[model samples]
Target: MLELLAPAGSMEAVAAAVQNGADAVYLGYGDFNARRNAKNFSREEFAAAVSYCHVRGAKVYLTLNTLLTDRELPQAAEFAAEASSLGADAVLVQDLGVLRMVRQVAPDLPVHASTQMTIHNLDGVKMAADLGMTRAVLSRELSRDQIEYICQRSPIEIEVFAHGALCMCYSGQCFLSSVIGGRSGNRGLCAQPCRLKYGWEGKADSYPLSLKDLSLAGYLRQLRKMGVTCVKLEGRMKRPEYVAVVTGIFSRAIHEDREPTAEEINQLQAAFSRQGFTQGYYLDQQGPHMFGVREETKEPKELFALARSTYQSGEAQRVPVTFYAMLRPGEPAQVGVKDPEGRVSTAEGAVPEPARTRPLTTEAVENQLARTGGTPYRAERMRVLVEDGLSMPLSALNALRREALDGLTRQREALPSRHMGSYHVGARYENRKEPPVLTLSVRSAQQITDQLLELGPALVYVPLEELAAHPEKAKAPAGTAIGAILPRIAWDREFPQMLDNLRKVRDLGVTDVLVGNLGMVAAAKELGFTLRGDFGLEVYNAQAVKEYKKLGFSSLTLSFELKFPQIRDLSKALDVELITYGRLPLMIMENCIIKNRTGSCNCQNTNTLTDRKGARFPVVNAPGCRNELLNSQTLFLADKAADYQRLGLWAQRLMFTVEDPQTCVQVTRRYLDQEKWSPKEYTRGLYYRDVE
Candidate 1:
């Protein structure tokens, strides 16, 4: 059966889901989940929610899907143990550290890869399978055909977002919120700054970044036919009424073989939608129609009342029970109740009396024992063995039936989960005597002049477009490795030409290629080029690093989101590197900022955006690259070279973005030596502080 997974931000939402026919519901128990801002349940509430869903024949999937630091990893592992003990149907997770801990603590618990993992393609999904994930909630940006491709090649089950609000940036890859407003999406508190107004090159893209809420309800059959095992709704942070309506709609569309009516589609939008709806990256369209911002749309008061009516009065889910009753002229009346699982309990009533005005019939025994309408249980079958002229008071029969049903409920609640104790932490990192190698990344040919090359770095990465357009810029002095940095956003219409551009860069003596996204990895492999993994790949954990290594990454750049301690511990597992200096690219945006705001784009690589705080951030425009939003302040980490080596990590990169040729040389020289230097305006970034 095709699974319709709903979101449950609170206990009320859980009831809303099951009452409306969700096969399973995903929610959070603490701040551990990505939707930490939502009204999540407590540990006690989580257990109750799980039990409540299980009793109703539905499953509860807990979301512990945020990236965790080293300090919080043990706590996350303990929670995993608790989830297993509570019999969670599965856990949706993003961090590879959590994946490792779950395998150790609760080996039997199925792990579903959260979309925060940014698994958009086959290789990304294959990596999930390699790490023991049983299912993957794929990236929302994937087209239907891309989803079909991943599903076909997937070793595990595929879960796709069929509906709800869409994120402007790719999941797990957005650091714009963190750098700009100190709210990291990877840590689960997104400020949602993308919803703000911004313009691009002359096009003036209104709400260019904010996408419309996704609605694929009309395409459920086509998706199921494509072998998509689970269709997930996107909002756990939304209201219970929203969950009830969306879940009920998709559930029927998937299970009842019913197509959504046009009226129902309108109800979906009226209930909660952003400028109507878009099918999203599904349907293979990334045109102007996909963009939308919030609009004024008041929901009908009647619709909310009707939706709440479904779960308020009675048990949200019904369970069937069979009953057996006995009565005799002088013996006590008794009733036995058994659930479908064969758990049985019997309750004794007051002693039967001799017939007075009326004789006791079999119908008399059955009538009192069969009334279970208010409870979770429904009487499916009833058998009564009775002697004529036996009688019992109505109160006695009612009490006996209630007692038996209560006992049966207790039996179901007592069912044990597959429990594994806490997982053990593995090996630790040791300090290295020698300092790690240094690499330099420059955006323009102007920054990689003779003075910078004199520093004699281990490797130098120039933008691929720069290398392809001017081969002279890629030429390095003897013993200094030269490579081309792949563009982060490689879109469809131009991807074929992008590959050709990569090949052109390769032919010009740039053998070492810094590939970021999965498509770049695939392209590098196809062209037989040496692939260097960039930080854009989101390699946040040891497992992800190993997976990329297995995919033939010669060198790996760890995710910038990791704290210093996490970077240290992860480096112990693999010889990884971190960027030590430069203006970190905060966003790789599809829409051109200059074109939107200025009413014209000079197509020049230089542009600046002033935020509400009046801080100016640089915008880099280049061939083959998306609009690059650089951080307002540069990242200065040269003072931490010793600290980097102390973690047993081997490399520190000096990135030169928006810096002039002279500043690049000066920065390179300062870092090459043990010279302490910090730019006038620089940030330590996420290195020292915890993301949350």
Candidate 2:
């Protein structure tokens, strides 16, 4: 059976999930998780809580999924080591640094890649497997076919989000909150700015960016058939009642291999939902129908109360045990108990100085032993041996039973934790050297006019799709070495067109190409082109960067989510690029926000999505039927020119996503110190205050 995984925000949620039917429960490790805002557990709380789940036969995973700064990596690694020492089944990770340093901490602990890794393709899964990731939580945006393909090809186990609140932006990619006010979603502080009203020049009273809750209860059979190893329910911050109701519905559905009833579906909705529910990107259905805002509706009292009753008492009598006892006069009464896992414990009371009055009856002995009401164990069977005149004191009998059970509980928790093998250093590992040059990523050929090309940069990058669409408008003149930036995400529906565009760009004599996501690496390799990795490649650590360097990438772009110091440290390992100027892309939503309102994309080429705060975020109609939401503030790092040289980067990629040709020229000159430039509206972005 596919494992039914549940989220536990609190110890109470853990009890509810395990009692209801979660095969596994995953929670945060200290504060290093994607849900730091949740009432996460302290170290002591985590140790005690996991023990409670352990006795109930439920596996516990520690979530270390948030991105870690270089300074915080050691602490995060130490936390994983502690969790592993406490007997956690596995640790879910996102940052590559966590993946590398964790092995040094707990060598035998299983590391499952978190969905925030955005592992949407088989190549990504393969990359994880190559790095020794035992399991992968595929991106929630993957379709059923794509997921099945990855499952078939991936060497590691696949875990998918079975139910949860769907983020409008893909996991691990959104920078809206971070750039807006320093609250980074990648580091577990998501303001959920998507839920705020963002209009497309319409009167619709709905939140366009907010997708309804994803309910995959109706598709468990399909996932099971596709060989998914685990179905994860996404609500660690939710109430215990919410976790219980959601876990129960999915557990029953998975167990019976049957679709949930409509009543059960409504109960799930009533438990907690945005507006109603959506199946989300699993089926590859992205459109207006998949959208919904948070409709103010309380959870059904009956359902909430019912789920609450499932774990009303923290002490759940789940562990079954058998006991053997011998009571004799003038000797101690010894009691031995054995738990299900073959662990045995015995405790003996003080000498049973013969009962003074009313010799201890067999009925009284059974009564005292049966009072295992408050403990986590239930005595299924017990065997008693006694002499003809044995008279045990009630206090001694009670003490012996309590001591034996207590010893049994300690024995159960004392089980040794398994360690994953340590990471071995490879010969390919190398560090950065020399000051980096500069590259320009122009959105339009108009921005790459002949004059701008005269500045003499190392390389100029143009979008392959845009170049193919308008070779005349996007063409680079003679003597200009132009590299094409391929699209980041390649869906099945867009793969054909993307391949055609790659071929067209190849035929156009553009051999230098920059790859975006993992899939693009394979595509660019197949075309026999020089590959430059993009920011979307998510190179966060020295190990990950070295891996890419070993893969033959000419130069890689470090993720914008890193601080200047972190980038400098990673750059010391390999050639890397950073977008020093231009508007940062906040999200690449599959569902077009503009089309959701007008039912037609007129290609107006210029329109804004007005938010509740009246901040107008630029929307670009991306190729392959996608939409890109640009950050309202432009990322300008002209003042950090010396820092780039000090960091020893490969180059500073000045992207011109929305800037005009003249502004591109001005920005280029300013970067080169050929001309002075300053902007009234600009942001330092993560370069100053990185995500946690």
Candidate 3:
């Protein structure tokens, strides 16, 4: 059966979702979850909430889905183990390091790949299965066809976001909040900078970044038919009433196999909306219609009050239990209760005596046992074995029913035994004395000038599309190699053409490939090209580096979000690289910001989005007709060469985005000569400063 998964930021939210017909509730255990700002459960509160949900036939999924450093890995692993002991049905995780730690420490606890992992294709889902994830929450940017394609081929269960607030950038890929406000969304402290207004290409200020909330209430049945295991509702930061209202509507739609009524849609908007909802991504109709800012509106007190009254009453008939009773002349009367899962409990009452005035009938005893009012359970069926002329007091039968129900509740709430193992942080690699080599990654072939090549950088990476368009330009000095950089986001439908392109590039003598997303890793390996990991892998700790090494990556570029000290201490399981120059990409968006405003493609030109503070972030075209928003200030670290060299990295990549060929050459020259020159506007990019 398809599951309806709801978000629970607080204990009240847990009850609201469970009572309203959620099959499972995913919540934060502490500060480790993605919604750290939500009123997450305390340790005690988590235990209580788990018991509450379990007894009512709802599963609990703990959220440890965030990036973890080496120092926090052990603690996070221990938390996963604790959650397992507290009966968490599973854990959702983003970081490969955290996934590794959780598997090691709590092998019995199933792990799901969170949406923050940026998994959107069958290959990505298969890779996650290979890594031991039982389910994969696909990227919300996927269209209906893309989701159905993945679902058909995925080895593990597939989950799709049914209704939720849409992030302008893909989940797990945004760095705008961290770069601008020192709050890392990967660390669960997003300031929602995407919700703010900005100007596009010298145009007037407008809310171009904010996107309307996604509502697929009309598509749940279709998704179920497509073999989607679960549909998740996104709103952990919302109120309990919001959880109740939304979960109730979606649950009814799924259970009834029909769309929600007009009144329910009105209730959804009143609960919360960003100028109503959009199915833009689901229908593959993304454009200006998808952009909207949240407007202040009056609260729907009557609707919220009705929802609160329903959940808070705590009388939801969610679980169905069967009653079995036995009465004999000489033996004590006995009653047993069994839940749908086959968990049974029995209780004994006073012995039945010969009736003086009236004899007990099976109907009389069953009538008393069926009074399961004010409970989450309802008596679905009952069987009573009553001997003729046997009498049992009504009070005794009521007591017997209560005791049996209590025992059954205890049995239902019991935690499953899970194995816990030890986790030890691996030792750091010895620092190498050799100076790091330089590599170049350009947006287009035009950025590869002869002057830059004369510097004899170890390797030059050009996008696969760019290389395919200009196969003649796939040339470098004998000492420098040319590699193809795969697109950061590619749907499964594009894989056939992408494979053809990869083969063409491979036939061009390009033996190396740089892959930033997990979905492309298998294809790159299948074609026999050397694999190098990009920053999109989000390798924040040594364990993730080791994991990637195990995944067949010969080299990896560490995440730019890491501080210098954190990067310096990572264990070098394989060759590791860092970005040393050029503008850092803040967001890789599926929606084209330029096309939304201009209704045509002009991404090759110099375009930018100006914020309210006048900081202009460059926008460049990405593969698949998407857009990449580059940081306003370039990350220039030529003067910090010595500091980088001491970290013992294999290479320092100069990402050449939005830079002319001349500028790329100039920047490469400065880094090669170890010149102490500074650009008028440049940033260290979270290297010198810490992010929350």
Candidate 4:
């Protein structure tokens, strides 16, 4: 059966989800989740919520899925440990260091990889699976056919997002947030600059780049039969009523035989919608409407009224929550427990019996409530009509209300407030001034080893040629052309350059490396280097993350083609840490950009490219190439430090080369030093499938 997962922004929303029907609820506490602005749970609330969900037979997944940094490491670890202890079914996460910390704290807890990890293809799945990840959230950008291919080939269970808002940025491959507003999407401090309106070459009134929400309600049957284990909804920033309705709709469709009609989906669209819903990248179309157009609609007064009415209709009247009565010998007493549906009954633990009027204080009532594990939802003064016609003081009545309501069992709540937590430190390096994750191509082993020792890059992605030549020898020292890229390049018929590069890197005191070639990962294991898998391997989901784990790579980068739901699902299904910061290498071109024009091109010479910040990078135009104008955007995330820290990512990487290394390092460092640094806006780059 396909699980219908729903998003809840608060405790009330969580209850609504369970009440309506949700197989699992994904939420967060403090700042570990992606919806940093949404109202989330506190630590205590999270604990209570988890217990409530478990008791009700609903699974609770805590999102510790944001990227993290060195300074935020301690807090991230503590959060992960606390979530495990709180009985969290699993901790969704990204980043290697954070994963390591979680493993140390809760060895048995499942750590799902966040979509920010971006596992695109079978190789990426194998890599993540090897790393111990149990599942993968397939990227929404994949076509239905592509997802099926991944499912058939993957080593773990697969989950996908069936509905909700879409981002123009690819899940693991965006730098816009970091570059434009100091908030790294990879680290969970995305400012959503993409949602803003801007004029293109000729259009003035519309946001040509903004995307619509994703809706897959039409394909529920295909998803279930394809062996998908979960279907997620994307919205923690929505209202509780919205959560209830969406959950209700998806729940019926996924678990029951009844499929949703087009009419039901249309009703959903009217609830709270953007321009319109699309299938996202699932259909492989990049039309401007792929992401719905933005719309500003007033809140429906009727909906709010309907919600309040629903709340009242479902409320059980027993005692006022503020009542302050104490248990005494001869005062009037109230009796019975109230069910969630507000039915009154003589139950022991569900609701508490009324206590006698006595000297009562708020503290005493609070203590009693804690002891009884109940949260009072409503308070009212009910005359305890007795045969003797005796009445108590209003204070006494309040005390009684407090006692009864306080003692009621706590209920499930949604993810915690979006405002808490720290941004991953690595994102600080990913502002507008930084360079992309550059591949310094080379052909020798001896030259690049020393450089590898000095700079901890996003990844030292090596081409295939040199890997065959070096065949297990150490590379040369830093400061030479051969020092940075040569060793790992494929060189000989069977030189084993990958093993050679790793061996040399380890021997020269280098600890980290990145590569796409699967053979290189196995070879690196033989040499004992801390390895991270790269995008070239096409990791689109959590399964790929787990696959990489077994191969011995320490980290994994996500595919740049994933949509929002795919990103969230992948984050929730993994058991390893993930990463999602740095310059998104938009498209790995078959031919280098510099080949045609050694100087520059004027792609961003339009108004759509400029904002408060001056123009940053120019768009390069290759009029006849497979991808005609390539405009790569810079990452400038300085505001979302709290979010990344909460998600538990290890490092925010900046793919760099000597041409712009210092700028890359300084950008991150400056962002770390000052939490909010907005660079001049640059033309946004395409994360994947850049054709124009």
Candidate 5:
């Protein structure tokens, strides 16, 4: 049977999932994790939770899935070592430095690639296998057939998201959150602007980008039969009641081949819903609606009553169950604990027992909560209660506990008990290294040629916008961008300015020009210019990279969001040199803030946005535009240099910034320099390959 993995934002959620029949639960504990907003487990909480899950025969996977910076290396590595020592089954990772740390400190622990790594094909799967990845969580954008194709060719297990919220952008490849909200999704501070209502700047619809949730309940059987190892549910942001219901539904389907009854499935909608559900990109083709259309749902009175009863008992656990019930005055209730064996022994009376904190009956709880209306389920305390107005029978309360216990027992038994180590820990052989080549980004033909005389990089990169910035430089036509002038320059005499610049760049020592626009490609070919792919183009998959190569570019930069396996696949499949080092550009936006037409943005300049963990950062919109300047994602891979070189990498690029040039250079040296450098603990940004 396939494993049913669930998300847990806290120890309460972990317990709830384990109790409700989740085979395994994935959560974050510290800096390297993806969900910065979730109530991540503290070291003690994490260790205790792991022990609790293990005792109940459930598995715990730590999330170390965020992008990392040089400064965060030590903390990330320490967390990895701590997680391993605590007996975590695996750590879900998204950065290369962190991957290396696991390979050293806890060489025996398994590493699962986080979806932020954006992997999608058989070649990518093979590359991950070569790097010791045990599993690859295929990208959400893949169709079922595409995933199946990869599964057939892959050496490691394949895991896919079976349900939950879907990102409009490619997984881990989006900068919208960070660019617009100041919270980088790559670093787990996602401001879900996608859910916000918006009027299109030029489109027909009022809410152009709002998408629906993905629900493949109708297709669970098909996924299981495809040999997919795990069916993941994606909602750490939801309440435990939501967690319990979803977990219960999927757990039954995957384990018994028993899908929810129509009414039960409708219960999901009643609990909460958005536009509705779609199979998402799993069907291979879709529009923005593949995300789902938003819809409102009302809670059923019966379900609400059930939830009220569960909450009043004070015996509630948070991980796997959500109580949804309405309460009235004078309800009878019992307080008790349910053991792993499915037995519930109600404690004597319904009072707050000092030792066990046994919960009160409905009558007492209602009286206490009367002023508050009712108590919503609190994960931290594992309690829920109806207001002073609710009531229910004692026998009915016992029955509810029994039902909950049964679900928990079954969920706990589904996960594996043994340790699953780092991605490449059990590899049969080691890889050989090859030094990387270099690429230079120049502002003009003069700078290009001058630098080339003494330092000839393998490729030359330039920005389209920059050409227009310096019109008098005699490099390109006035106002025509690099993309537009590339074809018109050299051969077109009317474009004397561009011709001079192109000729000078070639004379200087440049071997190739990186271009993204088709006009530039056409211009380069017409002018007989040497060309290499530029980072401006978002090259995500091997197919895309190959297409660019066929278009005549000699090399390509893979999307910064790609996982190690995806990187390895592109490296092995294409003959062109690939660049792998540098501080990754986590955000690229068409909407410019500094140059915005709007005098000011709608966002409050002094408003502080709080992440899941309640850590707050002050908000600041870029001057003169609706575009916002959010947090930036940092990239570092010094610890995994040998691993990357072995994958046929040619060179790495470091972005030169006014503030971070020295630091970027130091980090680049740490990875590219050949003199016997000792490996220091580091966090792997998006290149993490552990996908199990």
Candidate 6:
């Protein structure tokens, strides 16, 4: 059976979902959740909500799915312990650090890889299972074929977003909110800058970044047949009425094993929608058709009122219960209630008397025990053992039934046992005594010149495709090494070809690979390439750095979102690098924004998006014809060489995205010589100031 996972922002939303037939609910428990802007639950509220859902036969998944700083890991681990004590069915996590902490503090608690982890391929799912995750919520940008390909071979359970708002950028890979403003989506304070309008080549401003909300209510049966464990609905910030409408409809569709009716679809749209729903990603359709902005429309009061009434009645009979009654001539009459979860409760009533004119019948006993109304339980089966001539008052049987049901409810609400261990954030692994060296990452082989390689940089990373195209570039000076960079986003269907490309590069004597996503990690390792974690891995905390090291990464680039103090305090479990120069990437979009606006591949041209403030953010071509939006200003820290060196970094990476070969050479020389120079337009990134 497929689980209908609904989002709950408040107790009202929890009630709305459970009462409307949600199999489970995921909600933010504290400030550590990605939906911190929602009306997240407090400790008291969370406990109450858990009990409420448990008794009603629904699971509660605590959301601690945010990037945690080293300073916040201990507190977040403590909260995970609290959630375990309260009997959370599972926890959804995005940060590897939080995943490590949860495993340490609450070993018995199950962990689900949140969609924000950007798990899209089979290797990613296998890696998640290897890391102890019981399930992985794949990225919403995957097509049905891609999803099916992964699900066919995944070791752990698979979850796909069935209905929800869509993000233009792949989840966890977005930095627009943080770079444009001080708010970070990874930290749960997204300002939603993607919703704003931007222009292309001085064209009319339009919402190229906003995508239509996804709706797969019609595909529940297909998803279930594909072996999906759960189908999640995305709307933690939505109202209780929206939860009721969406959950009820999707639940009905799943239970009926059919698509939703036209009327139900209308009710879904009336409840909430951005223009209309889209199945673009699932159908492998990507273009202007996927773009839409939320338009203000009149609320359908009647639909909302009816939806509200379904949950507000508080009489939803979801859980099934069985009753066993025993009546003897002299002994007390007893009634026992049992739920499907094997929870049993019993009550004894007054003794039965001898037979009267109206004797107690099996049918009569069953009639009284079956009146489980006004509760979340329904009488599914009944067994009565009455003596031949036993007479019992009807009121006595009713009392016994009520007491047993109440006891059963109490039993169901009781917390399940869990184990918790101690956790502590330790100091740095080792104090680095060596000064940091220079490394270069280029978008194409064209960015790599003989002069740049002559600088004797520690490593020069070119794209795997670029190296495959120009395999001769794999040769470098003895002091300078060459590596291949895996694509930031590759679906399961593309892995075989990606592997072939990797093999080609490896055959050319390129022994190093820069991995940005978890899916690429296993593949790169399998090919005998030395793994170097890229910025796309989002190594924010010391624990993640340690996690990457455990995954066989020889080195990793720390997240640009980190402040200098945070970077300084991170554990140097493995060699860590920082981007000292480049136009920092803002968003790695699945949809090609350049082609969406220009109706052709203008990637070779100097394409840029002009924001409302007239800031030009360059759009560069990525693998699979995707687009990467670069930050408006370059990250220039060549003048802060001493500051970075004191932090004990292994290397300072100069990312060359749009720069030409000559410019790349010039920038490498500046960082190599430690010359104090700054571009006319440059930013220190989030290193100097804190991000919200």
TM-score for each prediction?
Answer: 0.81, 0.84, 0.98, 0.57, 0.52, 0.98
Of 1 and 3, the candidate ahead on TM-score is 3
Candidate that would win on lDDT: 3
- lDDT by residue (310-341, candidate 1, tens digit) is 87867643677899998876677789998877
- For model 5, residues 555-584, the per-residue Cα lDDT tens digits are 655545555665665423334344344323
- Put the candidates in lDDT order, highest first: 3, 6, 2, 1, 5, 4
Residue 195 lDDT in candidate 2: 82
* Best-first order by TM-score: 3, 6, 2, 1, 4, 5
Q: What would the per-residue lDDT of candidate 6 be over residues 42-154, giving only the tens digit for each residue?
A: 89999999999999999999999999998899899889999999999999999898999999999999999999999988999999999999999999999999888888899
Candidate 3 lDDT, tens digit per residue, 63-159? 9989989998877877888899999999999999898888888999999999999998899999999999999999999999889888888899998
Q: Which ten residues in a row have the lowest lDDT in candidate 3?
A: 670-679
Q: Please give, for residues 247-274, the per-residue lDDT of candidate 2 as tens digits.
A: 9888878777798999999888888887
| Candidate 2 deviant stretches above 4 angstroms | 202-206, 314-412, 417-435, 445-447, 467-480, 492-511, 522-529, 541-543, 550-552, 565-571, 639-643, 676-680, 689-692
Indicate the worst ten consecutive residues by lDDT in candidate 5: 484-493
* Candidate 5, residue 637: how far the Cα is off, in Å: 26
Better of 5 and 6 by lDDT: 6
Q: Give me the runs in candidate 3 sitting further than 4 Å from their true place.
A: 201-204, 674-678
Off by over 4 Å in 1: 199-208, 295-300, 316-372, 377-419, 443-454, 462-475, 484-532, 537-555, 562-571, 589-609, 619-627, 637-648, 658-666, 673-682, 688-690
lDDT (0 to 1) per candidate: 0.78, 0.80, 0.91, 0.52, 0.54, 0.90
Which is superior by TM-score, 1 or 6? 6
Worst 10 residues of 6 by lDDT: 670-679
